[model samples]
Target: MRINSLPLRVRLTLLMAMILSIACFSLMAALIYTARIVYVAPQLVPKVSTSEEMGREPLPVTIPSVPPIPSAPPIPSVPPVLIEQQINFASTGFLCVILIIASGSVLTYRVAGGALKPVTDLSKEIEEIDENNLYRQVQVPPSKDEVSRLSISFNRMIRKLEKSFTAHKHFTANAAHELKTPIAAMLARIEVVQLGGPPSLEEYKEALQDTQCNAERLNILVHDLLRMNADLNVAACVTFSAKELFQSILSELAAEVQSKDIDIEVHLEDIPVYGERNLLHRAFSNILHNAIKYNKPNGSIQITGTRHPDTTRITIADTGIGIPEDQTDKIFEPFYCVDKSRSRELGGNGLGLSITKAVIDKHSGSIQVQSAMGMGTTFEVQLPNASTVY
Candidate 1:
């Protein structure tokens, strides 16, 4: 089998076993060589006599006459006991090497398993988590190492996913509710007209008008919902003048402004911005539309624009019935309205600000609102300056 196909623990144990086996065999060879030098080599090599002993030996000996004797059988070069000892040493060394390698392999396998236990546990914990149990967190090992860090990162990811899932659920429910209201209204009205047989021209006209209004509301709701989820096309973006854009919006809403007799004040520095012009226009128009719709009669609306080194900021402040402090943060949620009855009266589906926020985010810009109860509200928008960004 391929080495990689083996489990990590097995691979580690094998590697360690290889190293231990090599070391044991090398040690055995060295011990055998040392034994040969100390025992066997000495027996094989004849010793030389010293010069003084050789010089003095001839004077002390006297020759005696004797009969000649046959030489005994030639002595063996290596003694039998020495050969047996050498064989015994070789056999013992081989057995010791084998014993050491076997024990070392067992120890290495256990050590590898202990080292990998944390990782195995973490994997099992993660496997048990699914969408239904996203809230469940993996046990972070106390050993402040890579395994602990991995657990922490996974927990963070799970938290973010859970939050996103919850928000998605809320959005789906709100969208359905918003869609159902208009459809129900139209259906109720059509049913009434249908049940009333042989109705007069005036009654029919009234019913038709009511149905048409509900249908229009449904159409706008669907359009804004689609816009909120739509992906912007970066290729279609271009730089445009912020002042001119506001002027165009104001001009389009001139009739409402005239009827409300709301004074319009414009003090702008023709700040250039980089983004999709149509999207930017819609975002600014939504804010302005809310200001007009919610403002008190004859309330003054002030529009101002300032250019910073890297950003362009525009603020539209109006003398409108201000939003409650607690609900200000939630004003941009889809289908969320501060004053539901008033919003319906003004023909709003509560998606205008949501769409505005989506558009601003697409342009890498930010929008904020500041308001006090019974006081006026102001919306501030900041976008990247074309000159600086390009």
Candidate 2:
């Protein structure tokens, strides 16, 4: 097989085995060489006495004539080399090396597989996850190893992605539903006017007014949708005074405040907040407008701003028909209206709070609502202070 085509475990095993084989082969060769020097070399040389001088003359001695001495037994000669020993050793060492290579490669393969089991499991789990199976999570190993930690982080990232995808689908469906209403209204009104041939000035005026109103609503909704989706580059974000922001929002909605005959009270302190000014302004406008739109005639509304070293809080409280306790948690969801009929009467598209929440989220801030049925509702927004931002 091609080396590159092998699995990581197999590749690692083969590489490790090759390294160990090279080392073992060198060690075996050294052992054989040492055996030849210690055992085989000694037999190749005759044992010569140092006392016998090669060039020295033999001493003259009186010789006995023809004396015959009987020897009990003759000494056997020792073999200079053991070819069988060398052959046995060489064969054994070669067999041992082959055995080691075979067993070691298999053992290393097992070890590698054990180490990579988590990766295999993670891959399988990821492959199984899709839109229908987004809730599936990779099984986390109990051991606090790198593999286990990596799996945990992958699961965390997948969970975040799943949530984002789900929200996107929901947002898309809600936008379609919201846009459908205004467009349908305009179409219906035009069809009606066309069916009624050449109407009177009053009738034409009313029909035109309704159509124009629906068209304007459609335009506003489209603008808000675009704004919500448009990426706000954080590099352009800056700190602006919270005090001035609220005052400006109040001034902009002064006509609405006056028409409702609502009492507006403000207690604000100069404070800097970190965010995109336009998005923050939009968020603040939504909250303040909701307070006004839902306020009781001749009722009271309170706007308070406080600053801390790390955070700033803005509270918009109004004495209006409050949201139900059970539904408070879902009020921030896109196109989730507490009172659908009442919301339609007030021309509320239900995207206001969704946009506000998105803005706050973009700034890493939070918004919460406090309310009870028939009692007043309070929306409190908390933003990171400019001083606390990096």
Candidate 3:
């Protein structure tokens, strides 16, 4: 295969292996040459005497010339040229082995790289996906392998992300639509009060009250939206008694309860929870206020808390017009109103439940609602005991 087609990892591996093989081959050749020069040559050469002796040899001294000893069979006649040839052959063999290893390594790396390229591409493609773009899809080759499984999983994840993004977009659009009408009306009312002729004291008071009420509602709605975004960094580890917090919230809402002729019952168990006291109070107040606001005249609202071995459960049941089954799940959504007209009359921006839900979630607790149309509703909250470290 072409070098450029090989993946980086495989190419690097092959390159390293080739370098190592060449190094080993060079080392072996040097060792062989050194052995021949230092050890073999010394043994093969005939040694001469260094001690002083008679300067000239006697020529043809034939009397009593014993046959000269054969001098250890002439050191077995190993030709210098033949030894050089053997060394060359051995070096060539070593070179051939190195070449074979290098070639094999390169070929293996190329094959491995070709096999894994799809997986590497898939990883990079998946990494590029983010919240803003959930529609990009990976193309898997037609093969029954792990890559195919990965492709299937990636597709599923994309689908889920797409659904979540679509839902968020719809929620944002709906919230905008819901808030715009009230805001516009409030602005128009203010414009009329200003541009028109000066009004009587009572009329001025009423206009001011209307403007103030709308502004407050708008503020509450904005707060709820912020809370629903789940971007708050509120620390929530302060120790506070749940009972005392609930009592304070009830005291604050006394006037509202009295005005609506709703009887409030509080059952507080002595339970200390770790949370932000003000946030917890706000959550409870929202639930209690909603119950009173939506209840029938002279209805009863019951608040109760119980501490178990590992959890604290709080229940708020109101004799109010209950939520519809289909709409129950969405009641905690920001800007969601069960009865839009009635909500306006009640001076609500339809954000109380949303804020309440957010606060509860921040405490790592769960809130559940059980309601039937015209049969009133009950909200159950369970907070895990913080005394025990999990």
Candidate 4:
């Protein structure tokens, strides 16, 4: 593989080793040159006499013998052959040093390459991975070194990515499935109305009404999906009285409340909460509507609001078909319903709880449900007291 494809550590290590080897070889060459210039050349050169008398004849100086005087010994004459030999030896030493440096560089390159083989292989393996194939793991060496730790971390990251991808796939599939049904029903109803038939006026009106209902259900589903996609930053905070908001929502749903024969009981306290008014209204409406829609005939619906020192809690309890224990958490997911058939019969798009969750998140509040399969369901919403805002 190309060098650029190698892992960062391996590439750096190889480059560093190459630079060091070149530096060491350069230093060795410089030392050899300096030694030759400072010591070897001077020692090899012959000395010449400068005096005129010395040029004419050898002056009979009192050159004492070994016992007569302790004078320096006469310099030995350097033969042309000896000079040539010294030159040859120095040339040979220089060649040897060059050869050694070249050999060392080659050896170092090979060793560096060998040491980084595992890292290079690991990089190639990781690069080849995609979402469909995230199960591959690096074959870590048994050395238990830094590479081993790196391999372990890489494996963990792959596992997490796999899980994330799976969840995304599931969400997409579920959302599509939920959206398709109502659309198909609307189309079928319209097709039936378009085909000319000898049905009575009342039958045509009823068919038109059914078509309109399905269309309205589709519209609500689309609107909820859009709201869920709204930017959280744009969800501005506004101070609103919790009791007044609840009362307003209840009053708006008065007709539905009456039709359901659900008795509305409001126990309000003076509690102020800071959040987006419109979003909060949507959340409140969803919970209260759910209470009314799921209640038994003439069941009592209780709405209570209380303020503590730090938080404001609102409870909407209804004697309805309570949720199962296993489905409490999943209820907040988009396109999820406890009873799919019943939800469809009741004209619920299954997006209410999901939108409520998004609104609650914007307010930095929490919502919890307490329910038993046969008893009843109570949804409690808690918001931080406005007095505690920093």
Give the clash count for each candidate.
Answer: 0, 0, 0, 0
Please, what is the whole-model Cα lDDT of each candidate in the order they appear?
0.88, 0.86, 0.80, 0.80
Residue 252, candidate 3: C-alpha displacement in angstroms: 3.1
Compute the lDDT for candidate 3.
Answer: 0.80
Q: What's the alpha carbon RMSD for model 3? A: 9.1
TM-score of each: 0.74, 0.71, 0.66, 0.62
For model 2, where is the 10-residue window of minimal lDDT? 72-81
> Which ten residues in a row are the worst by lDDT in model 4?
230-239
Candidate 3 residues 1-390, lDDT tens each? 898797577677777787778777787778777767876677678767543455666466465557766566465577888689777868686877678777777776777778788888898888998766669988876998999888988888878988787778877887787678668878888788889788778878887888787777677777667766664344555767877887788788889888888987878767666666767777888898899889998999888888888778889999999999999998887768999999978877777888899988977889999999888999998877766424
Q: Any idea how many clashes model 1 has?
A: 0
The predicted structure with the larger TM-score, 2 or 4, is: 2
Residue by residue across 246-352, what tens digits does model 4's lDDT show? Answer: 88898998998999888988887677777778888999999998898888888888888888888888899989889999999889887788998898888786889
State the lDDT of candidate 1 residue by residue for 300-367, as single tens digits: 89999888888888899999999999999999988889989989888888899999999989877899
Query: With candidate 1 superimposed using the best TM-score fit, by how many Å does residue 245's alpha carbon deviate from the native?
Result: 0.5
* Model 1: how far residue 174 lies from native, Å: 1.5
* Candidate 1 residue pairs in backbone clash: none
